[model samples]
Target: MLLHASFPFLKEASYLASIYPQIYLDFGLRIPKPNFHGLMSSVKEILDLAPINEVMINSSGITFAE
Candidate 1:
């Protein structure tokens, strides 16, 4: 899927946090959350980085490679 939030719902949600915290209560928007861009960046980093096994081998020694 294309990396992004749930379209207009999240778009409108952006305003809900600032403009109307009360709207959150009205719409059950609890626990104000991070945005799609933040989440996407984190996911991208994980996908870009080598696996932990590879990292361990590189950082320590080949004997402990997974």
Candidate 2:
């Protein structure tokens, strides 16, 4: 299962993904919307618990600017 919109629940999502083999995390554009410091912290938090391979970065490429 994919963890959608997981920024708000980083600890929980990362923990689950770290323990469960079938669970995966999808961090869309949520992490990039913030400033540089925030972006770094967000990534750090995710990596703290979850394995690097279990995390997935997603980009739909469609925005609300239209």
Computed on alpha carbons, the lDDT of every model, listed in order, comes to: 0.32, 0.76
Tens-digit lDDT track of model 2 for 14-33: 99998999888887655545
Candidate 1 deviant stretches above 4 angstroms: 1-33, 51-66
- What's the lDDT for candidate 2? 0.76
CA lDDT, candidate 1, residue 53: 24
Best by lDDT: 2
> TM-scores across all candidates?
0.26, 0.76
Across 1-66, the per-residue lDDT of candidate 1 in tens digits comes to 111222324444334333443332121112133887765553333334323222111111325558
For model 2, the stretches where C-alpha displacement exceeds 4 angstroms are 62-66
| TM-score attained by model 2 | 0.76
